[model samples]
Target: MYAIVRTGGKQYQVATGDTLRVEKLKGEVGETVELSDVLLVADGENIRVGVPAVEGAKVVAKIVEQGKAKKVLVFKKKKRKGYRVMRGHRQMFTALSIQEIM
Candidate 1:
């Protein structure tokens, strides 16, 4: 079975044992996080959806790691003015493994 969960103002489609990174959450490694904003659940041909979120549906995940993403560079230049700007940024994220969906 698979489920669509909402976390950190984002939605994700996940299944049991799936590992993925999401926006930074408040927890340490090996911590259990219960994602309660389940938007949809699917099993074979049967599907359950919610108006905003599925009631009584939740996904359990375990934080495996926490880190930042690869650095991204932002460059800006003004032609004929010799003006230039460069910046780099790395977004923080947490890796979680889906343990169960209920």
Candidate 2:
């Protein structure tokens, strides 16, 4: 079975044993987190979709890792005036292993 869940303002499709990185979430490695914002659930030919979210439906996941994504550089330059600016950023993320959908 597979489920569509929402976390950190983003949506993700996940199935049992699947690992994916999402926006950083609270908790340490090995901690179980329940995603209650399940948008849809599918099993073979059966499908259940929510108007906003399926009531009582949730996805259970284990936190595998907490990390940051690759740095993104932002640069700005102005001609003749000799103005320049640069910045770098790394977005934090949480790696989750889908355990079950219920």
Candidate 3:
């Protein structure tokens, strides 16, 4: 079975054993988290959609790790007056493994 869930102001399509990176979650590695905002679920030929969220529907996950992604460089330059600017950013993300959907 697979499900669509919302967490951290975002939506994701997930199934059992699927690992995904989402906006940084406040937890340590090996922590268990429950996503209650399940919008949709599909099991073979049956599809269930929630008006807001299905009653008793939940997605369980395990936090694999907490890490930052590769740095993204941002640069700005001006031709005439010789102005230059450079910035680098590494976005924080949490890795989660979808364990089960219930």
Model 1 collision count: 0
Model 2 per-residue lDDT tens digits across residues 1-102:
999999999999999999999999999999999999999999999999999999889999999999999999999999999999999999999999999999
Q: Give the range of the ten consecutive residues with the poorest summed lDDT in model 3.
A: 47-56
lDDT of 2 at 80: 97
Question: What TM-score quantifies how close candidate 2 is to the native fold?
Answer: 0.95
**lDDT per model vs. reference:** 0.97, 0.97, 0.94
- TM-score, cand. 3: 0.91
In Å, residue 4's CA in model 1 sits off its true spot by 0.6
Candidate 3 residue lDDT tens string, 5-90: 99879999999999999989888999999989999999999999999987789999999989999999999999997999999999
- Select the stronger candidate by TM-score from 2 and 3: 2
Candidate 3's C-alpha runs over 4 A off are: none
